[model samples]
Target: MWLFLSALVLLAAARSLDWQAWLADKSRQHLCFGAAIALVPLWMLQAGIRDGLEVHFLGLTTLALMLGWRLSQLMALLSLLLVTWFGIEPWHEFGANLLLGGILPISASYFVFLLSYSYLYRHLFVYIFVAGFFNAALTMAVKTLAFAGYVTWSGQYPWQVVVDDYLSILPLLLFPEALLNGMAITLLVVFRPQWVRTFYDRDYLINK
Candidate 1:
């Protein structure tokens, strides 16, 4: 699968660069800085098919906001340009998606991170679990609405078809996605907390 290949490429690149060492170097950090800039467009292309450019832009923007104000601005510009280049949706829809994705996840991550450290660590499992659940729920909700409109206008399969065909498999899909996202976040926080931006002085509490 293309997804598997992409993962392999990222892993191979990380290994070839000795990313652990590179993470500590100021120059390499700048390279990451630029790559992060480049990532906006690439992420948009990857995410555009399922969620559209708006959602991808919003998600990246939200992540950048968690970093800081200045960085957020920079990322916002990059997101805008990337979304425009993709031409996947109207500008208004793009803006709305950006707002929804950016605000919701960042706020959720921030509040969760601000909670007790033990909870922050342990509940991250819960966080990703819930994220997966919510993502599935929201996706189903949107699809249901869309299907309803289609049936209303064209007199297609009854509403139950949507549930029977789509909702049934959601749990299976959600569990793995949640577990993977949780693991990724956990590894990043544990090994590369500095790159996370929002991980500030409070994170030091764990070691101290």
Candidate 2:
């Protein structure tokens, strides 16, 4: 299932990506390099807050905003593979990690982006709040629930303990997740808006 989803992501990227546009921009290589290279260390720097629950900052909302969902999904798959390759994560857990850790948060981030785009006014603040901070917090919440659900369902962790231990510290993660993604988006929107695919000057800045 993981391999199949990765393959589907490849296909989606091929169909959605502007191949010519990307090929024309040599600078995008640097951005890709920065994201891909930096994320390994960030992803690996995890804290085992509980027996089976590990906490890591998922900086994927920024990645999705920068690369767009298709490419971002592809990046997510690649990131997991790279982490597994380096032995940061065991090989057996790759599928579950890719689905729960990679696909879940990335997809949730994009979903938040879409909802904001559809319902809210195309303002800079709205984008930052909805697509950046809110998205990150919401994604983290969903991811936490998902991981908790999986552990409970698999009988790896008892429901009562998972609720008390694993779920206890969840609220503490939200603000930091929001800050990480919010600050990154704010910086990009302020300094290098062109790099963020979801940002547009005409939509976000024209009125201001």
Candidate 3:
């Protein structure tokens, strides 16, 4: 199952790559490298009861909001490779970890941004609150539940133990996730708005 899922994730990532676009813009290439470099340390600062089931401040929501999901995945892959190389994470579980902890949350974050962009009021605070804060909190919640379910289904841990040890920490996780990502987006919007790909002054700041 792990091998199969890993293969599928690799295939999806390959198909998702915008090679021409990435090659055309050198700055974005640097951005990807810089973001990945930052993420490696962030992911290292994780805590958990068991070996494979660690919880960390996932900066994936901000990554998705900044670079779009495609580049976010690429950046995550780069970070995960470094993590694995450093022996913090086993290479054998790389695909499963990336699929669950990286791509899933990143995609969820992007989906929330899309919903906000389409239906919500186009205000700066709305963008910061919904796409930045709310999205990070909600995505982490979903990822928490999904990870619990995956562990239980894989027979690595029973449901009760998973709930008690892993799921129980979720509430504590949400606020920090929200605050970190929210503050990040806020600072970027104020100082380096161009760094955030999903943010547009015309959309959020022009009319209001």
**Per-candidate TM-score against the hidden true structure:** 0.44, 0.90, 0.93
* Clash pairs detected, candidate 1: none
The most accurate candidate by lDDT is 3
lDDT of 3 by residue, 1-208 (tens): 6557745765787688878988999998898799999999998998999866789888888899989877787788889899989988888777678778787889889999999999999999999999999999998998888788888988989899998899999999999999999999999899989999999989999969
**TM-score between candidate 3 and the true structure:** 0.93
Candidate 3 accuracy as lDDT = 0.88
- Sort by TM-score, top down from the best: 3, 2, 1
lDDT (Cα atoms) of all candidates against the true structure: 0.42, 0.83, 0.88
Off by over 4 Å in 2: 2-6
Per-prediction tally of clashes:
0, 0, 0
Write model 1 residue lDDT over 1-208, tens digit each, in one string.
Answer: 3234323433443455444664577864573456346556544543311232112212332243235333433344455456556774446444333333333333344444444334534433333333323433343334334434444344444556644554445455444433444454456556766655544544444354
Candidate 1 lDDT at 5 equals: 39
Model 1 has an lDDT value of 0.42
RMSD of each: 12.1, 1.9, 1.6
Specify the poorest-scoring 10-residue window by lDDT in model 2: 1-10
The list of candidate 1 runs beyond 4 A from truth reads 1-42, 45-77, 116-173, 176-180, 200-208
Give the C-alpha miss distance for residue 138 in model 2, angstroms: 0.4
Which residue pairs in model 3 clash with each other? Answer: none
